[model samples]
Target: MGSDNTDRNKPGIANFAALKTAIVNGEDQLVRELLSHEPMLDIEKSYLIDLAQLNKNHTIIKLLENISVKK
Candidate 1:
């Protein structure tokens, strides 16, 4: 995965809202890292792929695609 220094200010994902915020900002590494620690990641679906496609961020779209979310 590539590093994105754009998210230097946002430190952690305290809740689902923060996860959404990370998705909106196209924070791939952060999102992946956070999801690794988030137990609810699979239980709750994240619309990051849609957001990435909507924003035309191919990097994020690809990143999100690689993630396997089991419901």
Candidate 2:
């Protein structure tokens, strides 16, 4: 059987939780990695951006901004 990581494709509780965990834990590398993989987390959800803002995560905000610019 092939290993499946498709769940990572869809934005859900797990994805949101991972992102939130990265942010809350101040894991910059993890946060950047997650954002780079799924830019939609920021584009599709306004709350993520707001959360970044509230947390003063300039790097995350920049990642989101770059995504917006590319799209």
lDDT of 2 by residue, 1-71 (tens): 23255655456657677977777676778877776453454355576667778889887766656654224
User: What residue pairs are clashing in model 2?
Assistant: none
| Candidate 2 runs further than 4 Å off | 1-11, 36-44, 68-71
Q: Give residue 34's error in model 1 in angstroms.
A: 2.2
Residues 1-71 of candidate 1 have per-residue lDDT tens digits of: 12455354246335556656777887777766656533334434546567767777787667666667664
Candidates in order have lDDT scores of 0.62, 0.66
Off by over 4 Å in 1: 1-15, 37-46
Q: What's the TM for model 2?
A: 0.58
Which pairs of residues clash in candidate 1, taking residues 3 or more apart in a chain or in different chains?
Answer: none
